[model samples]
Target: MSKLILLFGGLLIACLSLSANAAPLNPLLAPLSALTAKDIAIIANDADPMSLQIADYYQHRRGVPADQMIHIRFNPKTKVLSRLEFAVQKKRVDEKTPAHVQAFVLSWMQPYRVDCMSITTAFATGFDEAFCAKGCELTRKSPYFNSISSLPFRDYGLRPTMMLAGNSFEDVKALIDRGIAADFSQPKGSAYLLKTADKARSSRAVFFPKIAEGFKGVWPVFYMEKEFIKGQDDVMFYFTGLTQVPYINENRYPPGAIADHLTSAGGVLSGSKQMNILDWLKAGATASYGAVVEPCNFPPKFPHPGVLMANYLRGSSLIEAYWKSVGMPGQGVFVGEPLARPFAYPSK
Candidate 1:
């Protein structure tokens, strides 16, 4: 990749040499530390019982300071929120958010979209049509993409947001517990980068060789040319692309594990013709990403495996790593425990 394309917001790509068998290149600037509970603000909707319940559970589990909670009320049964409806509510969140809060945990699942923009992107960048595309075109690029700053909002005026999403209240609770269980307890786990036969979906395979080489001695980066992974017990990170992935339930996803399949409407969270990222979460993965709208097959729209691992293994939280991986995130939703850092050292 050219330096101009890899570069963003005045940050250089640090010589991204992707040639096979080449010396490792630096992909991420090591952040000072992963985001802690205190750095994240919780936004809960009073109208949704599930929203309120999840917020309370997350706050209690993560030890989020009571003052950091921001409450808003809206009918939570709808599938999408219009720009006006979202702007009014977003104002409340931005106004009430504590200055120290660096990121947001949206404690609900519904209203995943604001017009054409995903709600996560809406919250992260506000409702801007510049992020929406008419067809096969580029959208807004995130200033936080592949960035080194641990405090995104403080550094770039962007608060990376994540949803504590699940099929049921119990599922969300388990997700939170997994994140808590993962902190500072870095396990020896495998990072699976599967390159499937589906050419369009597997456009990301071009990035695997360099990722594997860079992470060789530090973490086990397995670049496999398989359609799907099954029966593996040590899975910590898994990335691939497909409309509907199979055998997801067959593998073991350790606590704090992050996985995703790049496909349209995977961010829909439910009722889409394609498989959603929630499948990974339910199958034991801590976090995943998918576009809420049809973002075409642009590799920048999905999580770059290299960027994801580079940040995550360096002790950035799940939200930070996942958000940084995607160059353009206007169409996607990020779901997971925001503060799952399995590889973090306590002293850092």
Candidate 2:
């Protein structure tokens, strides 16, 4: 009996040691303490690679606590109280394990009532309906709803399948008629996007002034860089809805003269820096685009050499097309034609 007791004590020590060596889940949440709100905003708006970089940055800096983990026990009755207490197990349950530290950081939000939406499940392969519906709900409930009236968020819930294939304002109007929060006002009434006057209608800028005008206050929402600035029609959405910092680019060039120019014009310039997407992913929160690709700068595919040169000269790190698919704060992807610049990366 004494020998058996000794053996159990040895096992407990081993378990504790193993738990100490495990990795963390939310590595980026910690280091974020050092980052300014402007920096966080920058990374949050950048594509998926940069968003992940922000996540990783906090992970390494803050790490996870052993108490916030998953564990297992066989006592014939796995009670909820025991399960929550023994959540941090020493052994890894899955090879594709979340970094031990990450789990702790993610769990931290639970205590604060800040629920991190399950984007993976939301955008899962068979959950298309849920995806569209959730997107609509979020847009409606979010404080920034008024800014994105031109977006087809309302149609997603009513015609989930149709939305998967892309949609138009007419399609959404039908959904709006069916009571899907479709009331939109631009410049208080009409003639915002549909303005006949060339000057009122002209200007290759979207999102910034338009959304700012629409919301009448700054409300954070998904933001794109180059695309928002190139199309004069794009700016109309802002005028009709709630958007904040309309001039702020999601992915921006370094803090310098170029950034000032883009902001003033309600445009963004990407590819000005030589940042590696993967490294940015590792950083957890602070990432940026390079300098050259401003709004209306990079044309659709097969852009002229002059366009490419312009991008190169600006020192922008043009994100590879595929990397920009996953958007953040929410997983909103642009299904438009080839002209659409890289979209946002979803926050995991």
Q: Tens digit of lDDT per residue, candidate 2, span 14-39?
A: 22111122121111121111111111
Q: What stretches of model 1 exceed 4 Å from their correct place?
A: 1-31
Query: CA shift at 164, candidate 2, in angstroms?
Result: 27
Model 2 segments beyond 4 Å from truth?
1-60, 70-205, 210-348
The 0-to-1 C-alpha lDDT of every candidate, in the order given, reads 0.83, 0.19
For residue 251, what is the lDDT in candidate 1?
A: 91
The number of clashing residue pairs in model 2 is 64
Q: How accurate is candidate 1 locally (lDDT)?
A: 0.83
